[model samples]
Target: MSTIIEQNQSNIITDNGLFPSNEVMLDLKNLKKVYPTPKGDYVVLEDLNLQIRKEEFVTIIGHSGCGKTTMLSMIAGLNPISGGRISVLGKQIKGPGPDRGVIFQAPSLMPWMTALQNVLLGVNQVFPHATKAQRNDIAKYYLQKVGLEDAFNKRASDLSQGMQQRVGIARAFAIKPKVLLLDEPFGMLDSLTRGELQDILIEIWNKEKITAVMITHDVDEAIFLADRVVMMTSGPKAKIGDILDIEFERPRTRKSVLEHDDYYKYRKHLIDFLEH
Candidate 1:
């Protein structure tokens, strides 16, 4: 159902007309990041390049300080680039915009606001021209999709950590962003909760088909959720070390993926990279 086209240092995964089209949605060229300190300039990333195609899910993995989060922040326009450019659909990113929705490790919701109200915050910004009823519907729709139908009216402070994160997921998608940026969105939860959230995320992504980029350290999680697993070398000048194409069929379940012949092969390869 998908084809892997190997590029210079990256792999492009394309479906056979399942998505709208096989086009580059996110492009990073000669990307660099630096922090000027009194001692000297500290470089975080240099000459990092990657292209994420439409409807593709790419996960980045690396050792602790490999600039994975830095790169992701640049794409989200939350951080400034020291050099090069990152573009979405041919347009260069200047700053944070509605087209890209970011979900960080923390839910970062306002304690005073209810779950539905938190979702409405972004919906209101993105759909200002739409009627209030339409915006409310959009917010409610995503909340239900994330299995927060009963918690819609609950204040964020009153909800469990997992429930708060569900609200975060709902808020990010409610904006209908063209690209979703996830920085260990489930890192704070228990293994069971994390797995449940992963399934929920993939289910939503299957239907939305939004281009996604995630930063994760979990090897199995990276393989299960990604079309391509990007491995980054150790920092303080991290660059992509290698890219692995995951050829698993879509509508993937944990059991099906784990049972696949190549699953452990992929796992071993990732483990080898991380250990070495």
Candidate 2:
């Protein structure tokens, strides 16, 4: 049984032990992953366990080859788990579904299609029963939310990288997925562009309250975006080494966070883990 936790208004732990919420939106139980090599099986992750609550933002961070992306793939149903099980909202995750949406480092919009068309494609597939008007509305709303209302008709190839990624974000949210998976979604962007997209993502997340799991290498990004930062050890059989619950107040500004002592403490802790 999972232990219960008491949360203050700030979500800072004033008393009691560290425990995940009772309402688990996603559960990974003793999860394992192994790949068959020419010589033998190469295990990437073993005995991995984690529980995420509904609408919670969780980020996984570690050194390279730590299986962070691999773990995200498993959750996305893109890869098969060698052992253990993944449950999403009490349903077993056997394969991909409209319930989960993934955004990768690169914007995956089709070069042939316009931003509106690209977003509508996924929304249409996910909600096939909806009328054309409804689907159009859904796509446009998300696009507008991501600050791409004027660029709706722009082709993916014509748009800037950051703008293209905005379309991807719009497309993912248009599906109204229960869970959102992000794999270094801003890894290639400039610092200013990355910050802009991060703010957009945060705004969407706050409004939608969709459960999110992201894989990232940046400690500051993980700290700013995650409700909990899960640190993994190095692989060939990597597993979670630590889980740090972020105690920062919501509507968090970058300036405020940087000035806070707790932020540096959290940053230092994560950096130390990655270094040694």
Candidate 3:
């Protein structure tokens, strides 16, 4: 049995057996991933556990092949878990659901679809009850929010890399997902474009207040966007190495974060973890 308590305007669900509190949006318990190879079973992640609170933004950082994407895909229900369980709001994840939205390394938009059409594809699915005009407005609003107002009718194939990603961001957010899973969404963009998109992402996240988990190899990016930076140990059996909480106040800007006294300290810690 589970208990629901109202605390400080937040619903905290507690089950003496499993869930600790309702404030927890995503919970991963004793998670494991194993690949069966002819040589033997290759374990990628073992005994991984994590909890993300509602509306919190967490970033995962690790060297290449540390199983960051594997963990994220499990949470998204895109991949099968060999052991343990993943739950969102106390519901065990079995497969991909609309409750989780994903932005991959590539935008992954339908090239033949116009930006508006691509976004509408998701908006329509999520808001099936919304009237035609209402759904159109919802899609347009998010597109404009991501600075894609002028690119609304442009085909995805015709858009620049940065522009396509903007559409991806807009599409993911427009669905009003409970969790936004990002797998190096900006990895392929130019530095300037990446910075611009980061700002856009943060601004929208601030307004939307969605719980987010992102994977980044860039320490600065991990620090800039995360409320907590989760470090992973190097793989064949990668697990959480450490977690660093970013204490800077939100509605944050790159300029403000960079100038903060703890900025370099946080950067050094993340870099040191990756290097050593």
Candidate 4:
């Protein structure tokens, strides 16, 4: 069985109605992915194993064509694993569920919908039992948290890319998902905007304690946001290369983190890994 212990270790029931437990939030055991091609089977990932504790922020980094995003897709139930298993809170993932929320490279907002409406769409679907006022409050609270309070009424087509991404982030969080899957969510943004969104994401993660798995190519961003930085080998058959535990204390700032000795050490290590 994937679950080591299924009993409730804590009495806290989250707003999403899940009883938080002292257990691994996500577990991937011997996970593999393969695609059949005209040439033959193309292996993307194999013999991969990883475990994330409850509320942990883990980032996967590698060059293009690595299976980092594929791993996230499997965990999100968007793709089927050809081998092994993925378990969330000890239960195997079957398909897309409200327990997992995803933010992609593009905001993917509805052009005709206002920012608030776009956010409300996901919130309502995930929380159909919630009162209208309650759902409205949830939408407003998350939008404000992402610094999009003033853009509530603006249509998605009218908003800047950064603002639209803010709406995407708000929509993802409003659902109160136990796990947040980010596939290069800020990859298309400029450095300044990406940094801003990174800080906002950190604040939300800190507040909500949602387990997060983000795939990124940016070393600095990975160090800044992740509890553990997981590097993957370049793939025809990719697997974890190394795992680096970030020791920076919570409420981390870019300036303070950049000044730390271990920060540079970890950076150099990651660079060396990617180089050879």
Task: Report the poorest 10 consecutive residues by lDDT, candidate 2.
Answer: 12-21
Best by TM-score: 3
Clashing residue pairs for model 1: none
Model 3 vs. true fold: TM: 0.94
For model 2, the local distance difference test gives 0.88
| TM-scores, all models, native as reference | 0.93, 0.92, 0.94, 0.91
The residue pairs found clashing in candidate 4 are none
Q: Candidate 1, which segments miss by more than 4 Å at Cα?
A: 1-22
- Native-to-model Cα distance after best TM-score fit, residue 229 in candidate 2, in Å: 0.4
List residue ranges in candidate 3 displaced over 4 A: 1-20
- Expressed as tens digits, the lDDT of each residue in 1-276 for candidate 4 is 233244344554432333343466887888999999999999999999887878789999999998888899899999999999988887898998879999988999998999999999999998899999999999999999999888899999999999999999999999999899999999999999999999999988889989999999899999999999999999989999999989899988888899998998999989999998
Residue-wise C-alpha lDDT for candidate 2, range 105-136, written one tens digit per residue: 89988989999999998999998999999999
Candidate 1 residue lDDT tens string, 2-121: 333433324333332222223778888889999999999999999988888888999999998899999999999999999999989868899999899999899999999999999999
The models' CA-based lDDT, in order, is 0.90, 0.88, 0.92, 0.89
Tell me how many residue pairs clash in candidate 2. Answer: 0
lDDT of 3 by residue, 1-276 (tens): 022443534534454323346678998888999999999999999998888889899999998998999999998899999998899988898799889999989999999999999999999999999999999999999999999888889999999999999999999999999999999999999999999999999999999999999999889999999999999999989999999999889999999999999999999999888889
Worst 10 residues of 3 by lDDT: 1-10
